[model samples]
Target: MNRSSCAIVYNGNLGSEKFLIQVRWLERTAREHGLHVQVIGNQELIPGIVDGSPVIKGRYEGQEPDFFLFWDKDIRLARHLEKMGFPLYNRASCIELCDDKIRTYEQLLNEGLRLPKTLIAPLIYETCEGIDERPYETIVQELGFPMVVKEAFGSFGEQVHLVRGWEELLPLVHRLKHRPHLFQELVKSSYGRDIRLQVVGDKVVAAMMRKSEHDFRANVTAGGRMAPYEPSEREREVAVTCARLLGADFAGVDLLFGEDGEPYVCEVNSNAHFKNIHDCTGVDVAARMLEHIMSKER
Candidate 1:
């Protein structure tokens, strides 16, 4: 703790160039606050068991920083750092829960938060040949065709699908049976639209309404356009509460409009990409995040 230093654990498996840019922004922002930051990929440190205890291989051999700014969804590495007593922003549990869409909905629902009716898909091991379509009948009957099928672990709406017919669904289910997923009733009111609220330290710092006329997913990464939107008092309340409930130091909370115009939790991003927000709102989210982390360090 003598020198201000942080390690941003990022995912090396992801090849997105934007991830690299995110690291650069974070490093530059941390410097603004006089904190030295290093970007470390998960692959750099191999996890192993030593004497029947989980330990990071060669963890002590390297420069152990005072803080961990986890930018990856590698829960095991985050947990290992936590066990090593390094302060981690957002924490491993929160990142894990937020990484899995099904878990996020479940946890939020259990917290008495409103969400679109969602059904978890049955688990299918990768070793299994495939899955039967019988159980999907309940899914079809409950949510109907044109429902949303979201993979448990995904980002930027890449693994999210809009099943418009039974024919399209069976193959998707068969293809994704081995992976965890969920079916959610389509929020028609929010179809091709949603809101992204960036929450930090009890404040909704930036808000945007993402809309896509050509696609169902409103993610800017999904070709949606973002416009600065003023959230209603209730929207702000929901977004802030969602972040607090997840124990997130900062997060991008997506909210959907229910049929009755009520806001429901759509998803939470522990490592939310703020480049789009900066483009639209002209707000430097990286600076704010760095400031929030520095506050915790103090």
Candidate 2:
């Protein structure tokens, strides 16, 4: 029998154990499914344009894989691969939307998904002369103090900030004003806690409740602890819908709780790392994803 094949694309610069573990799990699972898997780094694939056509320079010793499991946020490379006729698990468009928090929210809101009240920061070009503090008062008046500020593009909750009062919000906004960002009304009820639901295809495969007593963010990379969680039907539906709406084949959807325990879309990760979820729930998300990929292959 001829086994199927795939290339798992990951970030070239990120050699951290957590990130590598995700790649390793996918490789292992792909082999178990009788797939010939080739691990690739995004940097290794050099993309270029020639004569109004997309071209790529890379090392693939064999014919193109059945699909590309893009685990990196390199949009250009992902797009190039798509143009080259290789199907990607989560398409380039999906990655682009998820990479920018503002875009993700806009798309989700368009579909009528529940989310925290948000205000987008105006764009500040590098050539712009000075900071505009005009929007500060209006933002504080709307979202009030103790709001959440997030860079449009970030991972592991590193670029997310919790600001209290006028003093703190001023400097942080000034610092991030040159970049894309958004301010959100803080979900006080879900402070220091949230649920992560891993969705593969149309189903919620694995879930975990994340808690952080020391920080306002519940991301595992931000020192949060994870516990196995069995989500309610409402939670499952919300997560699955978010993934489907985002055009993602697999996604990690974070849902923040409201005062009455309702779910609100925190953020959707098209290339979400699942090491913590695996360790917490032992669900083998990588295997499930590969199975989904193979099912789609048929």
Candidate 3:
């Protein structure tokens, strides 16, 4: 029995508590399954010189692996790995496309999936003209009183803001104007909860319901609690569709139950965290991911 070799590309030192936990689990699971695994940081492989020589020259020296698991935060390095003949899970384009909220929305819409009414604008800055032309009052009148303001490239619920009225929207718009934001209709009736369906190789490996008690965003990282939940037939279909549409080998589809009681995809995460889903569902997501890798190798 030949053991498969794997490498996980990530930036764990950047305080990704969730990612660290998942990677540790992946390492343990892989070892237990008779696989060799190595964890490499993205920052350690950036354009730099080691001992006054090009870093890339000997960076991967004597380190050839069978599969490359390019996790979150190392998305930018996927393309480089492609040239090395290593199979990257989710691929670079999928990670890049799914990371941008606006792009993900557009792709989902193109697939004829239901999502929130969204408006994306250029980054806001003090010197930018027409900043006030699109006032908060105008946005509220168009979208509604309660809305969501999200940074174009934010993750882990760090850059999501719920605007209840004009007063809140104005300050938030002004603050995030220079940083590329999107205004979306808030799914108020959903009660600050959403479904996360984890897909690996066209199969729904694990699913969970995340509900935030205090915040509108229901990300597990945003102080949300997770519970095991079986996805509806529609949810499973759309979750698989979203991953396929984005060409992701593995992904997490976030679907919110709307006021109309229908599931609307909010976003797709190419390198989604699996620890919470695993804990909530007892699915052994890391082991499933390793199994997928091994099968692909075969």
Candidate 4:
């Protein structure tokens, strides 16, 4: 008999309390399944030499694991492992797609998935004095006031904002001028509320409804409360299809409600934290993900 083993890769800088909690849960769960789990940071795989080079001098010096339970957004390192012939759950491309909201929306739109009408903000160079507000003025004329402003690279609902008008929108534009972001038509029906369906492979393993009475964003980290949710067939299909199109082994799919109760893809997290969902619904996502990875490797 052979033992199955794998690695869990994470980012070193953003290893906060929640991140550590997720790591511990994964480590403990993997142990129960008779697997060797090595929790390593992205730095361990990429060395710091005088000139940038792909030299492995850290945890995985000369050998690669059978597979990886990748939970980080370090796409380069994830791709490096894939090049070494190690199968990664969710894969690098999936992570890359989910890491950027603009890119994710572009792909989702290309796939004909129903989603909020989003417009990518124009790129303003670093040397520019300030963004030309005329373009946004015209865009706002269409999207109207109270649009959703999202930084392409953000998480836990930190960079999401509800821009009411030019007063609020201009400040955000100046602040995030050099960064990649998008302006989305606000889903008033889904404001302060949404549904999260955790999909592992092709099946939705767990789900919960998140709502905030005081805030526009409903992320649990944003002080929103979660309740066990049973999505309708259409909702389930939308969530599952988004995950499949993104090529995710597992994903936390956030679906927003339209005026008529129609479901639209809000976001897809390739490596979404599952502890909150587990706490809310008592469905262990880590264990399921482990099983998914092992089954795929086999």
Output the number of the lDDT-best candidate.
2
lDDT of 3 by residue, 20-127 (tens): 887788788878877777887776555434575433434655467887778754554677667556688868889888988888887777676888888876555567
Which residue pairs does candidate 3 place in steric collision? Answer: 123-177, 123-180, 124-177, 124-178
Score each candidate by Cα lDDT.
Answer: 0.87, 0.90, 0.79, 0.86
**What does each candidate score in C-alpha RMSD?**
1.8, 1.7, 3.5, 2.4
For residue 50, give model 1's deviation from the true position in Å. 3.8
Residue 127 Cα positional deviation in candidate 4, in Å, after optimal superposition? 2.2
Backbone collision count in every prediction? 0, 0, 4, 0
For 1-298, candidate 1 gives per-residue lDDT tens digits of 3489887777878777888888788878887888776777789877777787766665444567889888888888889878877889879999998998887877787666789889999987788895777889988999987899999998899999999998899888888888899998888889999999999888899989999999999998889999999999989999988888888999999999877868878999988999989988998888898888888789
Point out where model 2 deviates above 4 Å: 1-3
List residue ranges in candidate 4 displaced over 4 A.
1-3, 47-55
Per-residue CA lDDT of model 4 for 73-119, tens digit only, reads: 98888887776677888799999999999888877876657888888
Candidates 1 and 2 compared: the better one by TM-score is 2
| Candidate 2: tens digits of C-alpha lDDT, residues 73-186 | 999889988998889989999999999999999889766567999999998898986887888789889998899999999998999999988889888887887899999999
Top TM-score hit: 2
